[model samples]
Every structure is written in C-alpha cells, then in structure tokens.
Target chain A: MTAPAAAPPFHRPGDLGEALRLLAAHPEAVPVAGGTDLMVAVNYRLTRPAAMLDLTRIGELRAWSDAGDAIRIGSGVPYTRIVAELATVLPGLAAAARTVGSPQIRNRGTLGGNLATASPAGDGHPPLLATGADIEIASTRGTRTVPVAAFFTGPKRSVLQPGELITSVIVPKAAGPQQFLKVGTRNAMVIAVCSLAVALDLETRRLGTGIGSAGPTPLTAPEADLIELPWTRPGLFNDALAEEFGRRVAAAARPIDDVRGTAAYRRHALAVCAARALRRVWTAAHGTESTR
Target chain B: MKVEMRIDGEAAVADVDRPGESLLSTLRDRLGLYGTKNACEQGECGSCTVLLDGDPVCSCLVATAQCEGREVKTVVGAVPRPVRDAFIACGAVQCGFCTPGLLVSVADLLAREGDPRDPVIREALAGNLCRCTGYEKIIDAVHAAAEAMADEAHRAPARSRAAGSTEETP
Candidate 1:
C-alpha cells in the first residue's frame, strides 16, 4: 500500500481586503466559506485547486445589514442564521433555507456557497430568482453587482470571473406574501427533484415564479407577467387561472431525465409545485382556506 | 501545517499536513479520540458529529484548520453521564456506530430545551442514520434521558432547601 496524498494548503484571510488581495494575487485559489459543497467536491476529487481560501474568518462577510430598499446578506452567513434571523424580513428565503439538508448541514451551509456552486438543484436559487435578488461580487480591481438572473451561465457555473469573490446578496423586501415548495425523494436530507417559488408583489400587481432542478439553471417564468391573478379578491383565483399558470411555468422548463427523476416527471412536478405555491400564497394573502 | 484548538476542554495541537483533512480525522487519527466515529466522510451520515463552539456540526466536513482557536467537544469527553446511562438503560446501542453522533446531537437538544416532545426529538436526530435497532430504542433513550434530567433538576432545588433548613436548626 502507498501513503495517501497530502491535502492542499489553505490560506485563512482575516479581512475582506486581505481576501481580495489574495484572490487577486493567486487566481488559482478557490474561496470556500461554509465548505459544505466545495469540500464534498474536493473529497471526490472533482476539483483540485492549488490552494483554498477559507473565508469563514472574515467578519465582514458574515454580517447582514439593512440597505435602503433591500436587505444585504453577507455571503458567509450560514443558512441557520438566515432561517433564525431573516424570517420576517425575507420569509421566502427563510422558507427555502429551512428546506436545505439537515440541521447540521444548515449550520455550515452558506448562501454565498450555494450561489457560487450554482447547482441546478440548489435550494437557494429559486427564492433568490423569484425575489429578483442581486449578487454582490468584489475583486481587488473593483466591486460589481450582477442580477441573479444573469449570474448563472450554465450548470455548476457562474458569471464570476477569476480573482472576483462574492461578497453579499441583496434581496428586496417582500412586496406581498411569498411561498416556496419543493418535491424531493424524502422530507429531509434530500436534494430537490424539482422546486418552485411563487412571489406575489401586490403593490406592483406582479406575480414572479422561479423553477429549480427542472432545467439547466434556476429560471424564472418568462410569462410571469402574463399570468394575471386577482390580488385583492382571493375568491377570484379559480382553478383555470392556477392551471394556466402552472402550464406556463412548466412550459418554460428544459429539464432532462436523470436518476433522481424523469424529465416528464420533473415537468409534472414543477407544474404541481407552481400551482400549489400560488394557491398557498393566494390563501395566505386572503386569509382563506387553500382552494387546492 | 500545524492546527491548534481546544478539544474536550483541553488544548490540542496536531500536525495536519493537508488542508483537506477533516477535524474528525485529526480527532481520531492524531488525538486518539475514536469516540467520534467515521462512517460517511461526507456530511450525509452525521456519524462524525461534534460540537464546534456549542453548535452541532459535521466533523467530517469541517477542516481541522477551521477549528483553530475554536472549542470542539467530542463524544468521548463531552457526553454527560445521564445521557450515557440512559442509552444503556434504554438499549439504544446496537452496532454503536451511530450512537456517539446521536448522543451528541440529543445532548445538545436536551441542553437547550426544557422537555421536548417526541416529534422534536425525532427531528433533532434526523441527521443521524442508525442501521440497527430501528430508532425506536434511541428515541426512548432520549425521552428517558430528558425525564431523568428534569427529575434531577427538580430535586436539586428541594435538596438545597432541605440543606438550608437543617443548617438553620443546627
């Protein structure tokens, strides 16, 4: 038997400036916050970066602050904190965060890590997409904000360039009731086979829907604006409108068959999830029993 | 590379060469704290659960370097006596592979909660996977431990009052 290979070296930066400088200097270094996803990949030998930049020690990246119209959540903030602290301000995000793996996984999984991973099945994406969130990225060169819609270029890929690090995510406060629903193999510790998030912006009379694990990347319904529902009158939401909305959401999906589920099954699940999420949000907004 | 941290209330330093080495590996291989079992190196199994700064996390996913200056509590030194006794009394140990993680997870839950219901206990231990005993005995162990701990807490104040009265009479 031969000896095991040594693990790669890691640089733990104390501050954001140091982290950015290190990233700028060493483009080959991969920045890891919670390490829930990245560590798994490293262990499986899927990725072999020359060095790892542990970002958990940076206090600036672990904070959440209230911006003028949006709430800024640091990338290093774990899902546990998001569920506990931001439930009232970002209910949809909190709901999505609660559905992530187990309590232990949530304790260490970070929002930034999830966004960085850009998995099609990522639980964080659908909610962020529905909320029209922005990803704040920083580099020694400068800082830039990209809309979440344009962030993911493909599966397990993001628009983040070399030497750039995701600093925080900016999500606008909910304009109305929001709900997230997911279909998985089990209740807990299961990746989403298909997920849907519905957000009703009453003030703007707009309904936003995001579908996950059903396509190449987390996607918002292109016909979101076309699916009209009576926001003020709950009784006006009929099964016809709900079914149409679900069909439109499912039509936007470009899913493929995989071991977890079939493409047809994923499309069916997305339709059901979308309809159910809309019904739940409608009921909550109207203080009535869910029609479904 | 050298990583230093407090494990089970004792300062420990391990010469971990690789950044990818988990805290669980260091605890078992270097410090000889085999109480924290290693079943799934991934975070799925939860067999290598440990308390990092009082938060229950998967030791297998946590890097040893991340524990620098942080406090870690493994099952060997950190599990309370009542929890251990309750496990044996309730016959929660089967293969014992998942017992350590379950004990640590349950201990954390019991410490923070007053008297959680059955559903809460089940949810708390959902991460831990036990191949033997089918989890009924383990749930019983947690319930039994909570009852015993609550009983002890109730008796402590009464015992203190009794002692105070005796001293006054003398």
Candidate 2:
C-alpha cells in the first residue's frame, strides 16, 4: 500500500463566486466533488495538485429546477437523489444511475463528478447524450452553456478551461419514450464495458441513440429517420428497423481492446444494447410489450 | 490540517497531515476506532462503511477534511444490541472483517424499512464483500434481528400497560 503524500492546503468555498475566485487564484488547485474518482487518482499518486477546492459546500449547486424549457440539475446532486427523485421525469438517466457502483457509491457519486471524470465508460454520459443535455460551466469571469456533444474532447478530457467549474446539466424533458441499457461482467458494482441509450421523438418521427464505453468519448449515432407512421400513434418499431438502428449505433463505435473486453465483443454488445433499448422504448411508448 | 467532527456520538478532532488521507484512516489510526475495518481503500469493498449524516458511505472514499462538522457513526455506534446478538445467534460473523460494515448497512436498512425481504437485503448489502459464509447466514441474521426487534416492540407496550394497572391499584 502506498502511504499518502503530505497534506496540501484545502479550501471549501461557501458560494460559487468564492469557488471560482479560489480557482482563479490557484490554477493549480483541483476541484473535487464526492471524490469518488479524483481520490482514486490521488491515492495512486497519479496526479497531485497543490490544493483541493471542495465544492460540496456550495448550496446553490446542489439543487434542481424545472424551467419548462429544460430540467436543470445542479452538479452537486448525487446519483442516489436522481434515482429516487427524478425517475419519472428522466427515466433514462434514472436507469443509468441505478446501474452505478453501489448504494454507498451512489450516495456520494454525482453526475457532475461523472462528467468531470469523463471516462468513456461513465454511465451518466449516454443518458445525457440521449436527452441532448447542455453543460453549464462557470468561472470568475462568467458562465457559459455548452452542448454535451461539444464538451468532451477525449477520454478524461473536456473543454472546461482552467478556473472553470461545471455548475449544472440542462436536460430537456423526453419528447417520447427513452431507455438506457448497460452490459457489465457482474450484476452490480461494475463499470460498463459497453452501453447504449435510445430515445424516440414522436413529433419529429426521429430516433436518437447514444453509445458509451465503445468510443473515445460518449457518442451519438447519426439521426435515423423513423419509418413513416402516424405522428400521434405509438409502437411503430419493428424487427428490421430496430436491427438497422442497432447496426448504425454499433458502426458509430470505435472501441479498443482492453482487459475487460475485446473490441469485437464491445461492438457486438453495443448492437445488442441498442436493439434492446429501442424495443424497450417502443414497448413503453405503445403501452404494450413487444412480441419479437 | 485540523479536522473536527462528531464520531460515534463523541466530539473528535484529528490532525490529518496527508493530503489524500481518508476518513477511514483518521478513524482507525488517529481515533483508534478499529471496528471500521479498512480492507480495500478503493471503495470496491465496503469494509469501511460508516454513516455520514445518517447515510451510509464508504469512509475510505471520504476525505478527513470533508467530515468537518459532519456526524459519523461507525459500526460500534450504529449497530444495535439486537442486531449484534442476532449476527452471533445466526453464526454470521465468520472472519469478522466484513461484519462491521455489514452490521452498519443492515442496521441502516432495518431502520428505514422494517423486515426487508431477501432481495432487498441482498441489494442493501451489495457494496459489502464477504469472502466467507456465502451471505446466507448474514441474511438470516438480518431477518433474525428484525424479528427480535419486532418482538421487543410488541412487548414494550404490554409491559408498560401492566405497570400502569399495578400503579393504579396501589
């Protein structure tokens, strides 16, 4: 076991402004929330910052508001709250949250933390991508909102600048039925090897697919035109259409071979997950189970 | 840094010198609360489970600085007598490293939901990893504890009623 390094100065800002000011003053300081992922890096001496800014104390960053246009989730909101409170409003996100590590991990792990880590395997990403969420960022200068698609540049990297902090995520309410599915080695406490989320927009007659753990970053499949169906009608999905959508989703993936799984296996898993999610969403929309 | 918090219902202050020091380290090394075992520090195992502000969290993942002004209850403080006795009665304490965390987790579950079914019990203790006893005995212990606690609740009112009648007669 590695002995922990010497203690560095720690700061806990009471407000978002103070946090930003602290960040500006110490660009070397790292921001920590829940500390589930960051602490792991710290424990292994992977990266040592001169100081740490604790964001859990900021009260405004711990709330969620429904603004009619979008549901704004504060970055500090833990996964447990999302699973418990927002299941009906954001079922896809709730489903992903339910698959996170464990009860203890869920209680401390936040969506903001997951975004900050930006691991391709992050379960929070696919749901956010599927919902077309926006990332709200803040610094001492000001705040800006970026689309989730534009946020990630690579694995464990994002467009977030120094001294900037993620404040909240703006997720649009589902236009129709949506579903998230993940494949892992174990039933619980495991990271997703590959995951997929599918959403159907009844008004637009379009389908959205988000793939995870099978690419350098969370990916969105190109919009697939839904088969012509009554705008008001549900249950338009069929075996052929679902299979085509799944194949497109799998084609968008650029997975690499790793210890957990092979690239071929991930592509295969992504196809299955995409198909399963589409079927589930179809069943949900129609209020009837799919026979095939 | 000087970190202060309420641990096991007692005020505790420890000088945490390491930047990456965890609440589990502070509890075990500084405060001598060895009941909260530290098996896997990566949060993979729940050996270091503790209640922070009435919620179960992996203490190993929680920094000592984060615990300032918070209330922490280890297994010694969180586990009730009935639950502890039930674990022993059901032979659930093999090796005993995972017992502290399992006890704390079960206590929290029982407090929130009385007499959870087997699936509920399994899900509640999913974070805790026990290499021995295969978890059947632990589930039995949780059931036994719930029954024992229910029995006590049933008898308390009756005993109080009997005492009231005797006092009235006298």
Candidate 3:
C-alpha cells in the first residue's frame, strides 16, 4: 500500500463487451490482467498509464474451449488451470508451469500476463511459442489472429496497439512430443536462468525448440536436425548436432548480466536447456531412455 | 472496492482502496487480522499463508478483489487441537514467527492428505521458511499432530456409539 503517492484510476468492466467499449473509447487505458508483472512496474514507476482496464470480471476471456482441431485458451486462464487440465496437450508446458513460482503465483499468474509482460525469462512464452500458438487481439474495429512469432517486438515489448486487447491464445492440435525445461536458482519460486521448449513431429521428422531468457524475445529453432531419424550407428550428426544446437541457442539469445545471473551463465544454461530438451524429445519419440 | 468474506465463520465486509491490493495487506490493515504475518510480499515465504475457501494460499500473493465472497480463515482461527497440542509437546514454538502460517498450512495438509509421510510433510511445508528450532522440532510437531488426529478419528465412532446406547449400570 506504500507504493506511490497517487494510484491511477481503475476501471473494472463486467464483461467483454464493456471491456471492448472502454478500450475503444480510451486509447490510453492500460489493460491490467493478474497484475503480477504490472504491480512490479507500477511500484517502480516504470510505465504509468492514466487508467486501468480490469479483465477479471470478463467471462469470455476466462473460458477455454477445444474445437476439434485447436484449443483456444482465454488469456485470463491461470497457469494452475493449464497445468492441471492441459498437461497431455503440452506436457512440457505443464512441467514448466510446475516450475513457475510457488503455488500461489501459479494460481494467480495467467498466461496472458506472461505474454503481455514479454519477459525473456517467462516460462509460458517458449511453450506457447513452440506450440505454434496464435494470439487473438480484439478492438472495436474487429478481431484478428496474429502468429506468436510476430507478437513480440523486443524485451518487454509486444505488437499490441493501445486500443487492442489480447482476447485469447489458440494452439493447433497437431503439436507433438512437447517438452519444456528450465534451470533456476531454486526448486521453486525462482525465475529461469534459461528455459527451452521442444516439440517434435513424428511423421515429418521435424523439430522445433523455443528458448527463452537468452534473448529479447522468445527464440525459436525451427529447423533443427531431427533426432527421430532411424539410425543404427554413430555418425558425425550424432554428437555434433547437439553441440551445434547448443551454439545455435546461445547465438539466438541476447542475454545480459543481471542480478539473477550473468550473461555467460545464461548462455551456458540456455545451451544445456536446449540440448536436454532435444534429448528428452528424442527419447519420447523413440521410447528410449535419454542418456542425458 | 468491497471485499465480503466469511472470516473464521463470521461474515465481514470491508471497503478497500485498491482492488488489486494483496490480501495480506487487507487482513493486517483493514480487517485487523494480524494472525497472518507479512514476511515476504512475494509468494516465496509462506508467512502470509491463509485458507482461501479451504485451500492454503499465500495471502500476500492473492489479490484482495479475488477474496470477495470467499471463505478466508486466518491463524486466529484455532489451530486444530491435535496440531496445537503436538506443537506444544514437541517444543516447536521458539520465536513462533512462522507458527501461525505453518499451523494453518499443516492443518490444511493433514485435513486433505490424511497424515502424509514425513517426506511429504517436508515437501508440503517447503514454501514455509522456519528460522527457529532447526526444523526437527517442527517436523516432530507435524508428525505428532497427524498421529493424534488419526487416533482421535479412530476413537470417535467408539465414543459416539458408547454414548448413544449405554444402558444405566446402576
């Protein structure tokens, strides 16, 4: 309560329609979801908007629906719900969610807040990014789906306009062999030094790994050498590819030396996370135990 | 913002300034429920643990607005008699800073988990940071509490049946 002298005026909309109406009228109003990340910013006076558009009462943005081919998660859905219900859909994400903060943080923090905050170390980012998620942004004009790849502009920045609201995130049904891993300071309640999420396609023999905290935005390795290929003996691609993947992950990350960790440590952790993710994916695909 | 809560079996409503303020602040400042201590404003420390609708949650992390119409029980609510007796017998109350939160958190665990193993107890209370007693006494207190509760549950039916159909043995 001792945050700042004057808090901004808050506007609580009862439904999505009223929320959209407020956003349409006041372009300067900031959308407050969860307030986990925003509270820190507000306390520090990083960015102060005149008004807050509250989304807690909007039922439309809090419901998740699976429509045969894809699952549309309302942006307001907390990570706890995702971990409990959607584990099989994306196991790696569930694993990562278990690592997010303590239970209370997971209970209150939403995937929408993670994306909107756009922190490089956000646990929700790499999993959603690797799953080929699409964000639906709504305004009075209309609603449009934007690919997650193009959603982030930089550290703590996104492609959303002032009057736009991220309504939901849609993940396609075809995602396969998903795995997420992160190394932090502790078992729980610690932000990631580096995190990675990998999804493998069994039929196409293609793999994608999204790495976070080593970059400004979530970094994706779209065309990694598939470990699912049938091979009998050791080859040059066997040992070297993992090292290459590590280097690629390091190259993709634009990490900085912060209080939590150093840039060098982040690079090292990113490589480890990326290589371990690949090994886990390979094991899941082949039904074999990973040596790593 | 108005926060209506069933606190310790009593209906209470409080008008708060910021809806986004944490429940830890609300309990301490507005409702004057100081049983939940504020150690870490973040969720790392379980000092602010309170039962939200019968589930143990860090009151410091949950927004006050979310507590509206929910049942919130603070440490002022009696620690289950078994747990309190165990804590006393095991000498778990040194400074007793973490006692309230630990008691509430452990009470919820015992109620839900039905006397978990020692390892499970450690894992369950991992979020709660206890600086005193070196944790051995606390663990002892928890185990004793669980055993006592189990004993009481076993004896309850016999006591009830004996009380109901007892013929007067003049």
Name the best candidate (by lDDT): 1
Question: Candidate 2 on B74-160: residue-level lDDT in tens?
Answer: 998998899999999999998999999999999999998888999999989999999999999999999999999988988889898
Looking at candidate 2, what is the lDDT of residue A24?
A: 93
Model 2 off-target regions past 4 Å?
A1-8, A223-236, B158-170
**Superior candidate under DockQ, 1 versus 2:** 2
- Point out the higher-scoring one by DockQ: 1 or 3: 1
**TM-score of every model versus the real structure:** 0.94, 0.93, 0.85
Q: Per-residue CA lDDT of candidate 3, range B15-118, in tens?
A: 86754566788889888888889886667778888887776777775666666677889887736899988998999988988888889888978987777888
What is the DockQ for all candidates, taken in turn? 0.55, 0.58, 0.28
TM for candidate 1 is 0.94
Interface RMSD of the predictions, in order shown?
A: 1.8, 1.6, 3.5
A1-292: candidate 1 lDDT, tens digit per residue: 5887653477889999999998887777788877788777766777775777899999999999999878999999999999999998888999999988888899999999999999999999998999899999999999999999999989989998889999999998898899889898777888899998888887787887778998899998979547867756777887777788889999999899998999999989888878888887887777766577
lDDT of 1: 0.87
lDDT of 2 by residue, A1-292 (tens): 6997644478888999999998998787788878889877776678775688888899988889997967899999999999999888888898899989988999999999999888999999998988789999999899999999898999989998888999999988777888888898776898888998877776666777678898899988874324343346555546766677677787889999998899999988887777777777777677754654
Clashing pairs in 3: A92-A180, A214-A253
TM-score of 2: 0.93
Question: Chain B TM-score of model 2, please?
Answer: 0.91
